[model samples]
Target: MSKAFTKEEDGTEKIRLDDLPQSTHPNLVTPSGLADLKARLAAARLELENLRARPEEIDSTMAIAVAERDIRFLESRISKAILIDPKDHSSGVVEFGATIDVVNEEDEQLTFRIVGEDEANPAQGLIAPYSPLGVALLGGETGGTVEWQKPSGVVELEIIAIRFE
Candidate 1:
C-alpha cells in the first residue's frame, strides 16, 4: 500500500480530500458576496489549523480533510470572482445585483435580487443571473412582461420595479 493510504498509529486511515466542482458560468459577485467568501475562507483555514494540531485525536483527520477541501474551494472562488457593485450599474436595467419586483400572471407580486450563482438563495429571494427567470428579466423595462419556460409550462411576469442598491 502507498504511504498515503497507510493507517496511522491510532488506526485512522489517511483521508483524501476531493476538489469541489467549479461552476461553468461566469464568476460575478457583489461586494458583499466577495466579503462573505473571504470570511468563509478564513474560517476554513482556522478550522483546518485546529484539526491538524490534534492529529492523534483520530476523528481530527477526517475533520482536517473536510476543512482542507473547503479552503481549496473558497480560494478558487475568491480568485475567480469579478466584483460588481449594483450601485455602480445603470439604473432601470436588470443587471447583476439589481433588486427587482415583479407581478405574475396570477397577480401575485414577488421580489428577487439578481446575484451571482454562488450567492443565490432562492428561498431568500436571491436569483442567479443565468437562471431562466433572471435571463428573461434582464434588459426588461418596468411594466414590461417577460416570459420564461418553467417546469410547469411558460410563465409570464411583469416587471413592476427595478432598483440598484
Candidate 2:
C-alpha cells in the first residue's frame, strides 16, 4: 500500500489543509478595521455552527475542520486587535487611517487610505500601513515626495492632500 493510504498513530489519515497566513506585524486597526474584524469573527462562528449542523453533507468533516480553524484564527486576530481612532492623529502627515491624494510623475492623481493589514484591499484603495507605498508615505507632509519600487521601476508620488476622515 502507498504511504498516502497509511493511517497515523491516531488511527486516522492526516488531511492536508492550507491555513490562512497570519501577519507578524503589529495588529493595529482603525475603528472600521476593528468593526470588520468583529464581523468576520461572527461570520466564521455562524459558518462553523452551520457546518456542524449538517454532518450528513458530503465532505462535511473537512468543512467543519476548516471552519473551526478559521474561527480560531479570526478569534486570535480579534483578541490581538489594537484599535486606533484616525481622528486622534495629525492630519498634516500621512499615517494609518489617513486618506491620501497623490499625483505621480505622470500627473496622474490617485487616492489611497492607509489601513490595518487585515483591512487592506489594494483594489479598493485601502493599503496596509506596512506596505512599501504606505511606509514611504508615512510621515510625509503635503507637497512632499515619496517613492516605491515596482516591477517596472521606482515610481515617485507627490502628496497633494492628507485627511484623517
Global lDDT for candidate 1? 0.87
Candidate with best TM-score: 1
Estimate candidate 2's alpha-carbon lDDT, on a 0 to 1 scale.
Answer: 0.84
lDDT of 2 by residue, 50-164 (tens): 9768767888767766776787788888888888888998769887889999999999999999999999999999999999888888899999998977778999999999999
Give me the candidate number with maximum lDDT: 1
- The list of candidate 2 runs beyond 4 A from truth reads 1-19
Clashing pairs in 1: none
lDDT of 1 by residue, 13-96 (tens): 876676788999889999989999999999999988888888788688777767877888999999999999999987776888
